[model samples]
Each structure stands twice: as structure tokens, then as C-alpha cells.
Target: MLRTRIITALILAPIVIGILIYAPKPLMGLFFLLCATACLLETLSFMLPAFENRLAGKHVDTIVTKASGETHTKIFAPETRRPMLITVGLAWCMFLLMIFGGAEGAFGSLVAGILATIMVGCFLADDVQLGAARSISMVFSLAYSVLPWVAVWQIYLMAPHSRYILLVVIIVWCGDTGGYFGGRMLGGKVFGDRKLAPKISPKKTWEGAVCGLLLSIVV
Candidate 1:
């Protein structure tokens, strides 16, 4: 896994640097927008099933008799594609608003509008409970996957331009690398096998987190 990560980084680093330094601002923004969309979709794909499971519990896996007298297991298969399409379309609209709206108030209003839309959608859905679950999952996925890229785009528009963006990216990369290596090498020794976030990330240790922070600061 480490070797794969290193090789992938080595291959993509130069291409990423080239784009960061030489690409036009609008082009870079668009690239990051696509990235954010992809990330959001991937996040939703991974999270929706888990969210449904939690919301439906044992009912999700219950067997039922159909009209044709066949037994079939009922699964919590929500409308995944439609929700994904709606979320992605709304995300694009948000990006466009960010680009042209300028005023922070306008952006805030747009966010409010989106939330209202989500609520309306929940009410209109055939299954209100499942719809609420899906809506919450979409919101979390958007925040987790898209907000940082939006921040990155905003930073890129700042005075120092790409240098600041590159600095942020390098710091993150260094931190991740440091955490991986530190955890592998000295995780249990310093922290007595304590985990940083055992529920969310079982492999992470306090020692690894400390090393990552130090590496980021140094870099």
C-alpha cells in the first residue's frame, strides 16, 4: 500500500504542479470543481448504504412475500441516482454563485436556499424518513468533500495566488506521509497502543497525529 501511494504521488505530483503553476485561474477553478463533484459522488456512494442501514435497521433486511408468492428480501434501496444528480447540479450552481455573486451575503443566501430546497424535497419524497436520511447524508458529503476545495479556490484567488495553494497542498501531503510512517514505526512505543480515533480511523494513533502535526509545522 505504501509503495503504491508513493508511486502514485510521484507520478501525479509533477502534473499537479504544472497545472497549479501554469493553468489559468478559471481553468484551475473548473478542475477543482470537477474534483469536488467526483469526491462528493464517491462519498455519497460509500455513505448512503451505511446511512440507510442505520435508518432502517433490521427492517432493511427483512424478507417479505410478493404478490407472485415469491419470497424476497427487502433492502433499503433509496433513489441514489436522482439524489446524486440533484446534489451535483446544486453544487455546480453553488460554484457559479461563488464565482459571480462576490458578496458574502449572496453566498450565504444561496446556501440557505439550498437547505430550504433540501427540506422541501424531503417533504415531497414518497418516503419522508428515508428522504430525510438521504438529505442529511448529502449535506454531510457536500461539506466534507466540497467545502475544502471551495476554500482552496478562494485561496487561489487571493493575492499570492498559486503559491499559497501549493503551500497548503504540500503541507497536507507532508502531514499525511509523516502520519503513515510515524504510525508504522513508532506508534505503540510513544502512546502505549492508544488510538487517536479508534471508531473513525482505527489505525490512527496519538503518536502519528503528533508526528503529522510536527511535520506540517516544519514543512
Candidate 2:
């Protein structure tokens, strides 16, 4: 899998870079939309694996694709894929509409919609803790997918000629890359659920974070 991933990256990275540099808007939109769609769908699948399962009811396992007696737990199963694709499509359509509507309208609507969706997800969760976790996941999902998207779009729109975009990117990029490798190599780690707060940031360690921070500075 790693080998395939590397080969695919090697093959496509230059073409993608070319598109980012030369094609700009069209490529960015296409890539962002694809990424957004895939990520959202994967998340929904992971979050709600029984999306198709419950609907199948008593005959759930008997509903096989072909000769098989059992339903395949494929990632891109027909039932799961359709909803995700549809949701992302509608979201992107709204995003495009917002683009024509003005920045305040666009960003405001985007963020609002995201927050509202997360809130809804939170409400649907089992309890307060689950709701909070779902909310956090949704928020992080939006930020991870949307922030870079907004930044890239804005960079193309606002600073087409400015060299400073690369400068800022390089600094952050170098820092992140350096921090990742440094932490893995240098940071002393304890295995299992060693708790610091045992309440907040429980999974985190004092060691790895410090190493990452120092590595970022050095880089």
C-alpha cells in the first residue's frame, strides 16, 4: 500500500503542482471538491457504519451483491456512497453560490452552515460526552478541509503575484515537516493511556509536544 501510494504520488505530484501553479482556479476547485467529498463520506461511514445495515432490516445479511450470503462491508458501498456524494455536491453548490454573493456572505454562510451541521450532529449523539466528541470531530473536519481551501482560493484571488505566499507557506511547511520527523526520532514516549490531566489532553505527552515545538523553531 505504501509503495503504491508513493508511486501514485510520484506520478501525480508534478501534474498537480503544475495545475496549482498554472491552472489555478479550475484545478483547485476540482481537487478541493474531490477531497471534501471523499473525506466527508469516509467520516460518515466511520461514524455511522450501519447506514445501510439498519435500513436492510431483518433481511440485512441476506442482501448480498452477488452469490455471497453476507453483505460486503466495502468502503464505497452503494448505500453509503450516494448520500455522501449528494451532501458534498449540495454543499459545493452552495459554496459556488456564495462566491458570487460576496466574501462576508460566502464565508459567513459557509462557517454558519458548518457550525449548524456540527450542532445537529452533536444533538444526535448518545450523550453529552459523545455529543461533544462528535462536535469536535465535525469542527476539526471543517477546519482541516475548509481553512486550506479558503486560504488557497484567497491566495489565488488576492495575492496572485506576491512571492510572500510561498514564504509563509515554506516557513509553516518546513516547521511541520521538521517537527513530525523530529518528534518521531527524538521524543521519548510512554506506551498506553498514560494520563497527564486524565481529563483534558489526556492522550498527549509533555515530551512529544516539546520536541515538535523545538523542531519547528530549528527548522
After superposition on all CA atoms, what RMSD does each candidate show versus the true structure?
Answer: 6.8, 8.4
Candidates in order have lDDT scores of 0.73, 0.52
Best-fitting candidate, scored by TM-score: 1
For model 1, the local distance difference test gives 0.73
Highest lDDT against the true fold, candidate: 1
lDDT string for model 1 (95-175, tens) is 667766654744684586469547744763567667777677777777788777777777887744499889998999989
Task: Kindly report which residue stretches of model 1 are placed more than 4 angstroms away from their true locations once superposed.
Answer: 1-6, 56-78, 103-106, 198-202
**lDDT: worst 10-residue window of model 2:** 53-62
Question: Tens-digit lDDT track for model 2 on 145-218?
Answer: 55555555555566553244454555564555454554455444543344334455444444455555675576
